[model samples]
Target: MNMPDPVAVFRTEAAELFEQIESGLLDLTHRLNDKDQIDAVFRGLHTLKGSGAMFGFDALAAFTHHCETAFDRVRKGEKPATSELVAAVLAAQDHMRALVDRPTDDHGDIGEVLLARLRCAVEGDAQQPASVQPNPAVVVAEAPKSGSNTWRIRFSLPVNSMVNGTNPLGLLDELRDLGECKVLVNTSAVPSLDVLVPTDLHLSWDVTLTTDQPRSAIDDVFIFVLDDMQLDVETVTEVPVAEPVAAVSAPVPSTVAAPIPPVTMAVQAPVAAAATTERETAVSNADNRQAKAAENVRVPAERLDELMDRVGELVIAQSRLRQLASASMDIQLRSVSEEIERLSGELRDTMMVLRMVPVGSLFGRFRRLVHDLARETGKVIELVTEGETTEVDKTVIERLADPLVHLVRNSIDHGLETPEERRAAGKDEAGKVLLSARQAGGEVIITIKDDGRGINRDRVRAKAESSGLIQPGAVLSDQDLLQLIFAPGFSTAAQVTNLSGRGVGMDVVKKTVEALRGAIDVTSQTGEGSEVSLRIPLTLAIIDGLLVRVGTGRYVIPLSAVEECLELSLEEDLRSRGRSFISLRDSLVPFLRLRDLFRTGTKPDMHQKVVVISTGTERVGMVVDQIIGDHQTVIKSMSKLHHDVATFSGATILGDGSVALILDVAHLVAAGQQQEAQVRAAG
Candidate 1:
């Protein structure tokens, strides 16, 4: 097994820390008096600085320290939290991220500019009137006493803390910075060499400090690691102090066995009483933390992809085994095959669940984007999100990010009205953009809706004609007219802007969504809003499909889309031959004869089956010769040469080593709907 690089781990953790800090700062915009958010932002910056220094990111540490100090002022009531301060820090946070990503690159000029802005914000906040300032008495940290007192502070960090980018020496140096201090190393917990892990720390520390600083100052030293470490701080007073111990540069192995010097009864009495109760509580808390940590293990994403590929291969191999067993007369071979088949299916299901992640993470990233865009465009845009907890395949979410960005930018730039324009239009000054996700069968529908000026059908048609994308005054449905916006080099905007109107993004959005085996649906109502929805499969690796033979060619119909199957006798098939419509119970559903559609050039069997499939509310039936049992399908993408073949989405290998195409349900349903419309027009 290969261990992960410590630097890589630090980078991942630093990314998360950046998110936490950015989120807190953005939330602070809504409530500048939120003390909890201030503290949270301060802690994130403090940890990022310490961890950056630990991982040799000196530039990041140096830059972040200034932001930390600025927040510290707000935290201590020296300067109130203001919008200017939050915006300045948010800008500085971006610089800090650059430092982390490229520590050796020259960022001196940028750093200086950001620091000046931060200083200006802080100085400006300090000039606020007393009536608007925070309550100094209630919010301030306790001031240090005039007289000095000795403190006995002992602490032991979690064994894996050092492995997690924590520097023990940094903590010790901070303690020394407080005042005169003598540290004693405790290594009695070290195990023998044969059984020891090199990365684990087994030592603790005991320190005696003489300082006038309040206890809060001491607590600040361990604030980042306090949740997982054991710390005991108590005052020892009125006793004659021991001889001033010389500062030691390093610890020797001999010190491992050396015992701590005994203290007098005067100091020991109070320490004994406090140690009993506090130690018990610390132990219980530590145990709980350890248990919670053990519950979840963070594995790199590439590893999960690798595991999924292996599972896919296992599924293919099991399919081959099942075919072999079916033909064999040996009872034992068939029994073994059946058992392995069941276990492989169970493993596949579990692997799929592991790859599923909530859409909330993807949605959370848009908050900062919306904030920045609002500031840029001078638009009062309120972004509302729903169904963030809906789960989708990680691959789907990753690929959907860019397409969603394009849709949202277009909505804000073109669809939404400016604040003043909204007011003039008898609408609220703040325009609304809503993003929502929900699961429908095996697909997750993601919708981006904006309340503003809807898509102008006349403008879209005029643009289409002017761009030569359509003939003059061509007849088209409302949906077809709206979809023309996705044509190459199509733009209805009169002028170009930074966010959109370059005629680049919407077409790319269409192509990318289609590449993911997804479909896009657009709807607009004049003067109300426009909604664009993307329906994407829950997973791409494997699927349960109903296999059937159209003449001699076999195809896989996604089982999730199969509503029901009906048998068609020769007489019924002959009667519906011209119309291709099936009356089931009362309503008529359009049916397509696959043998004719594919032009297989093979005669159909006497007993045919109509496999009913649907995409949303529209249903279509495909007539086939035989209905094979359900198969576990591992989808393989079509080659570029055949990618434009709209009838088939992809291909999969069968049990007998032959290839079968996976039907594109959305395309066929649309085709069926068009057929139904044409027949009605003819009538």
Candidate 2:
């Protein structure tokens, strides 16, 4: 058994905290007076600073402390939240991320620069007031007032708390900062040396403190560990001035404990005595927090990937066993194989569900991107997102993030008009960029749409001709012409800018989508803006497929795309031989003969089957010699040499240990549509 590196765990946590802080700041930009958003941002920063210090990320903690102070001012109503303040904190948050990632590297005065910006944002143009400009150390270590409430505090962290980069001494030090405090360790739970785990913490603490700060201040001290720790706090409304000298018998346990002499130490005597005074409210709250903590386990993503691979291998083994059972005539062996097959199928389904994450997590990061882009381009851009709850495979989501970023940037830079340009064109001053996701068949279609000046077809054609991508005056369909934008080194920008047009991103977007066994669709009107849709498979791992034999070769068509299968008699097949057209219920659908496409050089079976598959609005028929039953398809990527083969998306192993190609429905449907276009032109 290996333990996770606490540093790595803290880094992951810091990344999530950065996201939360960034999100709250972005929200605050719109509603500066929204106290909820203000408090959320402050808490996120506070947690980040405290956790950074715990994990030995000194630079991160130091840099974040300044940002936290800025927010603290806002929370205290000493300063109002302004756009400048939000922007300043947003920039500081990025620096904090870098510090968390590379704590040892020389960050080189960047912290000072950002802190200056923060101060300016906080103080604005007015002279800084004395109270609002207090020193950071003083702010943290302020003494308790003359007449402060007394409270008894007790807590015991989880056994693995120390292993998870929590410094119990640091938490105790924070309590001391509140005011005069006394802390005692309870070592009753310690195991024998032979059975003890060195890394585990078995000690608890009992503390009596006198502080003017409210109870919320105490809560803040334990906020990061509150979910998994048992904490009890009760106000000492009546405390005897002197109860027993034994209460102060033991010195504070840790070296980090303050040297301040214990004062009025008769709040509570010992852990045993405190246990008898069970405050139902505090205990019930602790139980509720612990219950909430147990609801979700934070497993590392790589672990999930490893589990998925194991499941995939198990599925393959089950398939092989089923084949063996089918050959042997033993009833018990056959029954066992059937049982394993059912179990493997269910396991695959469950693994897939674990890997499926809501697309909203992917969408949430774009809010900061749009905010930054709006400021950079001086464009009044409004970003709208829909269908965020639609789910897709986590792997697919991870891979699609870069492609989506490029698409959104291109939409804003190329498709959207500036506010001045929009107003002159009789449109609203603000341009709208819409991002949405929805499931279609087996694919998740993510669409990036913008309402601005549409693509200039004439400009694209001129650039394509100049680059020799297409011949001058070459006749092409609108769809084909639109696709030229994705060609390598293709750009319609008149001048290069930081965001786009070194002729770089669009081509990579196309290649990446293709690599995922996905397709890209583009639509534009002359003046109504443009829309780019990326159709990617919901999962890259496994799928339910309809297996069929085309000539001597076996192929798998995704079941989600299969509408219905029809038997093609020899007479009907021969009648439609030249045109390859099939009529069904008043519509003439084009069909592709896979035997001829693969050049198998074998005659088709007398009674052929046409598997009708659809991608979006286009449907195509695939002619195969035999229709095999449904099979659980664990998708395997084709080798680099055969990766460009557009007819098949991937390959899967059959129960008989042969490879079956998975058909690319989008490509086949496009081919069918092209054939229909050519036939119509001939007429």
Candidate 3:
């Protein structure tokens, strides 16, 4: 078992904390009055500062301290949480991430600039409003009781306390300052010298003290290491004897055996009689705080990835076992194989669930994008999101970020109009961008819709013709023309701007989607709006594929794309040599002959099979010799040299020890569309 590097763990944790803080701040910017979001942001910052300090990130701790203090004020209602304040903190959060990532690197003037903004946010440029002084009576009511009480303290420093620069002596010294104190080091579990690690603390402590300070003071002593350590404290009765005596020598009372109600009695008896009940309630409050502080658990991301890898290997092993069992004649072997198959299927399902994460995380990022783009473009834009709870594989989510950012930028910069323009067009001044995600037929469809000036098809056609991307008077569908926007160096924008338009982003989006084995579709109407949608596979690791034999070589078609399989009659096959079209349910579906397409010099089977497949409105039939059953395909990418081959998306290994190329559904569908157009043109 390899141990994680503590420093690396700290860096990872700090990065996640910064992201959570940034997300909360961005959300609060939209709804300033949302107390829950304000408190959440405050807690995130508070935890980050404490955790940084615990991990010996002093610079990060100190930097986060200022932001935490500001948020604390907001949480307490001493200062109102405002957009300007959230923006300032968001900027500071980025700097804090830099500090966590490279503590030794010089931040230069970035820190100074952010600090100035924070100060301005904290202290508005105008004169400060008169400070409302609290009533003296209320202050008295909140003051701590003045009396000595015995405290039984039990605590264990975190396992890595010493290495993290924490000194247990400091806590002991603070306890000693409270009054008479007896500290006993418990080393009963300390290992032998040969087995012991010097850097790891193996000692805990039991301390008995008499103090006049409130219990909160003791908690403050361990606040920095609270999350990583175990601590228990209970107030005991004050010694009956007047003078402070040695705790070891003091007589034990049965009343102190159980440390709860008696501790409540000791603190409140000396104060007003009614204060005893309040002190009991305060003890419970302290327990609640400790419970919440202990609830957080951190696990390394690599551990999850390792588990996924093991699951994948298990799936492959199971596939091999199933293949061997089916080939053998032993009934018992087949039975065991069946059992293993069921278990492996269940394991694969579990692994997939583990890999899936809610798309809400991806949705949260766009809030900040919209905020900044609104400011930069000087347009009032409101972003609406739906179906955020849709779950997709983590790998898919990771790759989708950049393309989504580009789409959003294009929507704001090019698709959406300025507030003045929107109003003049009889639309709402604030433009609306709706981003949504939903699962449909093994694919996650993410749509980005904006109500603004739609794409100009005439301008696109004109641009394509001028650039020689298309013939000057060539006939084309509106959808085809719109797709030309994805071509390199093609832009319909009248003027290029910093945000987008030198024809760069959309092409990248197209390439990226294709690289992920996904497809993109665009729809727009003049003066209405534009919607761009991406259909990406739910998971890239595996798929349910239909295996077919093409000229003794096997090929797998995505099961999601297959509609039906039909046997070609002898006369129909002989007649359709030049043009292959199958009649299925009174509809003429064009077919591709795999043997001819692959240039295989083999004679066709007497009865060939036509597999009908469709993607959206386009349908095609693939001619093959045999229709094999459904297969659980573990998709492996093609070699870089063969990456540009449009005929196959990926390759998979069959149970019979043969390689099968997974047909590219989108590409074949496009080919079918071309075939249909040519046949019509000939007619």
Candidate 4:
């Protein structure tokens, strides 16, 4: 039942608003004719300003007002939305976030600097566009005069309204300014001393006014606190033909007993009354719907996490129940265990879906990155994204962000060439970076591609050798040499620049991908472009694992990675010990022996199983004693002490309470490739 801190909520909402504004502005920068993006940006700024003022962030409201005005002009087509304008506003949006975050901090000259930039962007070098003077004719139509209609107004400020910084007296004063006015404060609902909250306003007002101003003027009195307060206004009558004494000097009546006069009655009879009634009804319905929506449901994130933890424990308990049921003679216990197993499986599936978030949220972020990088590098770059609706575990997406950022920065800085360089190379001046993600066979493939100068294999090799990262004259394939760019302190750039070239990004990308138990693939053509792809599992929490017995111990392999399983003949198994190669169809594939790798002294079973696993284009066979049926595995991480154990990615517990190590497919594939290379060298 803990309440959220209002200030923290305000800050969080403000930050989201800023991000939305920046994103919209960035989109508008790309397609200057996109009226929707321009309007969206304007609305975001407008909302931020209003919300800031509502939350007592006067400085933020005042500062954001200027940017909102500029965008409002763009939205209205008074000025075109330009790249320079978007850039200036994007910079201003950052400052707005700082102000929202720490209003008391000394911003000093930063505001002046940004404001100057904003003015230059909006107005160019011209004098301040004449300050948008209001038309005198419209003012004459709006101003109130004598011989106007009288309105009876009744309103009560929200009990906590004053505490929230809404000034009711200011509203009363505004009403007095409308025309001839009389105000009375009602204290009928005021509580006694023991029960009263002194800070909570208990006073309501009844006012009678004669004004030429429209009913909108009366509504404007309570506009700031209208959402939480009660207000009612009705036109009483037109101004009386005969003037009354200045002060009646008589006892005030409880209600006005005046009748409507015919002189100004025709203009106010049906139209104004009907419009006001309709608006109130609509507002009431909207408020009710909003309240109902808020009341129906809400599950806190911590609660969901707690439920997931309980589900994990329930899964463990179910595993124990199944083991105990199998060992017992009672048929009823076995049936109950079977039912529990089914329920637990369904619960796990539901929990996983709850944890899944669409990758589009993550993808939207790179649009801003691409925009900034294009500006910083002074290169015309268009970022194209696809398969954004693909969903992955939230945990995986969270960890993937840093690596993705580094990869993208590397692509912009090193993979893409300058505009002049691109034009000279017979390519379009605007370089293209395509970022795509899609789910394939239980893995998410994220690719960062650039249509710029391809990776120079010779340069990578030269750099690797000069840095002592590789032996001189080392014979390697194109893929192997290109991968040297991921080596620590390796760079081929001729000069270091602010964007990149300290030789840090790619290596970090490599390390992060490896830590996620993911694999990175690189492909390039001499003059076409370069593409770097990361293949990561759909979820890190659990997997459908195929358990197999190797000698006496059990091991689990990701069911996603297993293409198929086959029985290996005793003769073929013995012949492939030193050089493990298997013939399937007409192709030869490499295989590994788990018994030998684990140094299990026991002899292999009569019928050995070869589990065919593949990582990208590399296929490998793992020999085991027996194949166990597929089981749902809740993956548990190894202790920090075993973090360096590359052979197994994780560990999971079996229904029989035994721990089975989950094989690392990438490491095993690499080991198989190394074994194949050694055998070829010997031959």
Candidate 5:
């Protein structure tokens, strides 16, 4: 029997709590006076601090305690929630993640630096706020045993309480801290090893306490875990002076340890009532809300990836079975193979859905970035997002994050102008950066558009010519001219800054998008703005592709890119051999002879076909010997030797136990366009 590590479970939960904290903090920056948001932020911090302390994350607890206090002031309306304060906490949350990820690593003075900044942000030219006083209502003091009242308390925690970092032992000890207490453990609920969940809590305790403290003090002992637990407290009777030991039916057994001296804190009167009342109300609602939330099972990300791999393999195996069945004369085998194919497809769909997460998660992280960037550049820039509900593969989202960050940073530091510049340009005081996503066919188009100072075409041309990248007087279209920004080490900025400059970002964005077998497009106008769109496939693992036989080898064209297929007449093929252009719907579309392109040296079949494929606006015809029907292509990575093969994006295993290369539609389209440009230039 393998038991899950308690510490690992706590860390998983801590990560979620941290995300909630960050989200609330980010939301608070927009509505500084929203009390609900402030309370939400405070609750997240308070929970994180308590959970950290419970799990022995002392540094995390200590660092988070200060943040919690900072928010507590805002919650109590002492100091306001300034953008400075929110930014400080946002930066601190990143460090908290590091601490959660690497608890053993020494964080050094990073926490202290953040704390100092937090203090400054909170103070902000005003006198420092008074320190919060501890609650006096929770004070524990011992009076004479004769004057003490005995109470019988019985409690049982939820089975998952221990797994959630709640320790029953700690609760029992706190109860013991109150005067003379005898605890009786009831283990009847615990089962044998075969049926028991090791991490679950099963034992309940019946504690009899004789203390002079008020009822509120007893309530404070179970303050944190009052939710998700069944607790019953009743005063049996006031004990007389003659029979203190006989207050309860059971004597103080040998298991009862000597009570330690109690520690008392002095809390001011004004703080006690509100704090006590708030705790009670919070406890009342916690059980219902948190119990509902606890239903979700948190699975590790690697496990999902592993599951997806298995599903992909199953899909491939099913394809092989279908091929074998198609060749056989037995009807029953074919029928069974068809059913397996359908089931396998459904399973694959389910796996894909599991991997598809909303783009909102990707979009959410940018709020903090925009906030910090606005402050860093001393610009009033607003971030607007749309189509956040669109979903994409998780792997794509993760890989796209860094490139998107680079693009947004470039937009803020270079594309968007300073406040003074905007005023001079007769534009609104605040510039707008729009981040939007939408699904087109099988791809998701994520665009970063900014309404600020547009690209300086002359500066770009000058930079390219000065760097010897292009001809001095080359004529280029608007789109082509804008694309020069993605050339290696290309930049039009006059000087370097901490955020950008010295020529970076855009070229890397181009490379990253292409590495994912995706295409990027740039559109810009003087004084209006610019939009850089990244069109990436929804999933990189598997796709429905049109398998075509070119020469003696077979290749796949993404079904999403294939429009239609037409037979190439022998006469037309021979007459237009040098031209390599075919008439389609009264338009001349460029065609590529895969036989010549691959240099296979094999004769074309008698009935050759031209498959019309496209990437965005460009269309190209791929000549193949025969067209194989749609195939479920489980994409396999190209070998290191073939990594530089621009024509083939990846390889897939055919149903006939043979391998087929996946054609790179974007690259093929580019090649066709380049050929057309050359042909036109010669003509």
Candidate 6:
């Protein structure tokens, strides 16, 4: 097996770390004093900086340090987390991502500009003035006589600690900061040169100090290493004047017999007890990390895709075996076919679950998008998200990102009103935008809603009429009219701006969503807000379909969308032939005769079935000659030559090896609506 390139691994992990940092910063903007968010952001930045440097991404590491430093200041409470600082860090994160992605590319002076802005934000927050002073420096002008005392601390760090960036000398230096101090090195544990590990630490320390500070101050000296290192801390009192010479031997240790100190030199007893308590906690944390590392392995996404392809081929082969088994009378062959079919299905389902990832991964990046858009438009926009736990295929998530970006930008730039406008409308000064996702059977619905002035129907109508998209007074339903916004080159704005009014985004959003075999729905109530929903399939690889035949031609209807199938009586069908509807449950449902749609040029069977399918709450029925039962449909893309065929989403192979087209529910529904509109118009 080939090992993955370490650099590539770092970049992938770096992306995730950047997302965490950006998300933490954005969350901090809403609650500036959230200590948890502050610390989380700091850790993310710190980890990213360290990992980048380890992977030889020097520029990325260098750029990320400024951000880490800024968050550190906030984490330490040296500077309050301010909106300006959060925004500045958010911007810097973008630059860091660029550096991580294209490390060798000349970044020019972008880093300096972002760093300068960060510095300004930090300094600006610093200028607010302090209310109270903190602890003074470690070395003070000769300790005050009233509270002067000494502390005796003996500690030994883990042997491998020094190589992992812990400096024993640095810890000792901190101890000296308390007051006048003397440190004795204990090196008895050192092995002979022949048996020694040169990189390991084989020594410990004993420190005697005098200071006016409290006992807690002594603990502060070893704050970073206290949990893992062996440290014993206790206050040492003054020597008796009467028996000053006796103090030297009062508590002398058997291991260290030579000691001539002004104060008493005691054996390490009480200090050892304090260290024992922390040892268990340290050991437990180490064990947990080790277990976690053993349990998980990081594999590249391409490998998973390759595995899925192999599974798909296995499924196709199983279908062939089933067909052969049914024709032959060999009991053994039939039994083997059934076994393979069962195993292949189990494998396919497992592969699908592996491909399914939570939509939260996609929703996270939008927070940053909303943050930047609010700044650019100078609007007070608050983003609210829901249904984040909904999951979709990884491939679908990747493809939907750009289209979702366009939709969100359009909402912020076009649908939302400014603060003044919102105020005039008696709404809150700040506008709100909601992004949500949820699963309905096999489809995942992603919606973007904004509490701004809704679609201007009159303006849309005018633009559509002028652009020849519709007649001047076309009698379109509210849903139909809202959709006109997606027409190419359709814009109702009086003037063009950088953000919108250029007649661009909405149409491209439609195209992209449709390419993914998804549908777009727009609904708006004037002055209330507007909602745009993209309903997409959970996966494009394979699906459970209801295979049916109209005349001699066959098609697959996604099983997730099928609600029920009922026999259509010839009298009932003929009674509603022109209207193309069936009265079921006392409500009229529009029906399409597949025979007519496909132009099969064959007569319909006496017993026809109406398969009721839905996209959201809207249902349409398909009139078919036969219900051919369920199939494990492996979705194959339409060739570019037939890519524009709207009636079919994709084609698949049947067990008999015949080609069958998968119906595009969303498109067919839209076509049914359009067909209904045309019939009414003629009437």
RMSD of each: 6.8, 6.5, 7.9, 6.5, 7.9, 7.1
The lDDT per prediction is: 0.84, 0.84, 0.79, 0.80, 0.82, 0.81
lDDT of 2 by residue, 1-683 (tens): 99878889888878888888998998888899999999889889988988888988877876777787678768877688999999988998888888887888898878777777777787777675687774533332232233555577999999999877788988997788666688779999999999999999999999988666656667778876776789888655422335443343343343444433354244334522544433343456567857887997899898999998899889989999988998999999999999998998899999999999999999998999999999999999888999999999999998888988998899889988888899899999889999999998788999999998889999999999999999999989998999999999999998899889888799889988988888888999977899999989899999989989977788899998899999999899999977888997799889999988899999889999999988777788988999988888999888999976888899998877889989988889999888888887887
Better of 2 and 3 by TM-score: 2
Q: lDDT by residue for model 6 over 1-683, one digit each (tens)?
A: 78677788788888778878888888888899999999889778866766676667777766776677577667656678999999888888889888878877988878877777777787773442355321121101221334455567789999898666566765665466556777788999999999999789989888877665555456545544655688866655553435433343233333554544633444334434554554554456557756886997777789889998898888888998999999999999999999999999999999999999899889888888888888888899988889999989999999999888888888888889999999999999888889899998999999999998989998888888889999878788988888899999887777898777888788888898999999988888899999999999999898999989998988999999999999997787788778897878998778899999888999888889999988887888999999989989999999999988898999999877889999999987877777777777888
* Residue 353 in candidate 6, Cα distance off native in Å: 0.8
Pairs that clash in candidate 3:
none
Ranking by lDDT: 1, 2, 5, 6, 4, 3
Across residues 1-683, which tens digit of lDDT does each residue of candidate 3 receive?
A: 88778788777767677778877787787789999898678767767776677677888876776787677567656677777888888888879988888889988878767776776686666553368432321211122234466678889987888886677876786577556677889999799999999899989998887766556556655655665677777656654445445542453442545644665566556543433444454456567767876995556656767776677667667778888998999999999999988998888788788778788889888988898788778999999999999999888898899999989998888788998999899999999999999998878999999998998888989999999999999998777888998999888777888887698888889998898888888999877889999988888877888988877788899998888888986678899877777777898889888888888788788898899887666799988988878888878889999988988899987765677999988888888778878887887
Worst 10 residues of 3 by lDDT: 135-144
Per-candidate clash tally = 0, 0, 0, 0, 0, 1
Output the better candidate (1/3) by TM-score. 1
Q: Which ranges in model 4 have alpha carbons more than 4 Å from their true place? A: 53-58, 76-80, 102-105, 128-303
- Assess every candidate by TM-score: 0.84, 0.84, 0.80, 0.82, 0.82, 0.80
Candidate 4 residues 489-552, lDDT tens each?
7888899887677888888888888888899999988668899999999988768889899989
Name the 10 consecutive residues with the lowest summed lDDT in model 5: 134-143
Please give the lDDT score at residue 221 for candidate 3. Answer: 59
**Superposing every Cα of model 6 onto the true structure, what RMSD results?**
7.1
The residue ranges of model 1 lying beyond 4 angstroms of the native Cα positions read 125-165, 172-214, 226-289
Clashes by residue pair, model 1: none
Instruction: Report the error of model 1 at residue 55, Å.
Output: 1.3
Model 5 TM-score, all chains together: 0.82
- Candidates 2 and 3: which is better by lDDT? 2
Of candidates 6 and 2, the better by lDDT: 2
lDDT (C-alpha) at residue 477 in model 4: 66
